[model samples]
Target: MELGKIERLLDRYDEGETSIAEEKLLREYFLSEDVPEHLRSYQLMFRFSASQAEEKLENKPKVVSKRNWYSWTSIAAILIVALGIFFYNDSSRMLNDNGLGTISDEELALQKTKETLHMVAQIMNEGKSDLVYLKEFNNTKNKIIQID
Candidate 1:
């Protein structure tokens, strides 16, 4: 092909106006060893493009599928649930043989109740004393400001 035609094709190719056939022609021209010195850079580029187009992926891609993770997680979740159920059942099955059984004694129960009530009454009296101080402060504030 004429250098002028090749140059015009290149110009159209740059402007994105050339058809695929015109681009193939440009590639063929550039691939030839007789490419003009000025167009040698384009030759190198077209040669690289050709070589890359011929290249292929030799190995299949290593796809990390979520299936493995999901399977493992499900297995782990099942194992955890099984272990929890086993422990719960086993603990319940074990007898309360370690001095932890309940014994009923009316007198002892009555004494415990009385002591609990006495402590509750003491706590209530302490809280009530704090309430008396708050009431005195409110009364003094009412005397000074008369907030109705």
Candidate 2:
């Protein structure tokens, strides 16, 4: 191979314009034992590339069958549907058994609401009475701070 041609290819390679065939020619030239001293520095790189290309993978690719995947997916779907139906029927049965499916009269519901509110108000008033102790404690702490 002509040194001029190799120099031209090198320039093109550096410019990212060299074709695969040109690159192969350059690699072969650099890998040869008679590589010129000026081009000897590039020999190591080409030798490394050649060695890498010749390397064989130790582990073969694993082949997976998708047939079992479809079956498993279908089984999972069936189980989901079965569980959903079971839960729905159970919930409906519980609601019906507990008489929650029936509607109460508006007047009765209003009476119950008023009773619940009265109880809540009574509880809140009791809680407010307890807060009186908290107010006394706060006053005592403030007086102690002033003394310090």
Local distance difference test scores for all models: 0.88, 0.87
Strongest candidate by lDDT: 1
Clashes of each: 0, 0
Task: List clashing residue pairs in candidate 1.
Answer: none
lDDT score, candidate 1, position 95:
67
lDDT (0-100) at residue 104 of candidate 2? 70
TM-score of model 1 relative to the true fold?
0.46
Please, what is the TM-score per model?
A: 0.46, 0.52
How well is each residue in 116-148 modelled by candidate 1, as lDDT tens digits? 899999999999889988999998998989755
Worst 10 residues of 1 by lDDT: 94-103
Weakest 10 consecutive residues of candidate 2 by summed lDDT? 94-103
Writing each residue's lDDT as its tens digit, candidate 2 over 114-142 gives: 99899999999999999999999999999
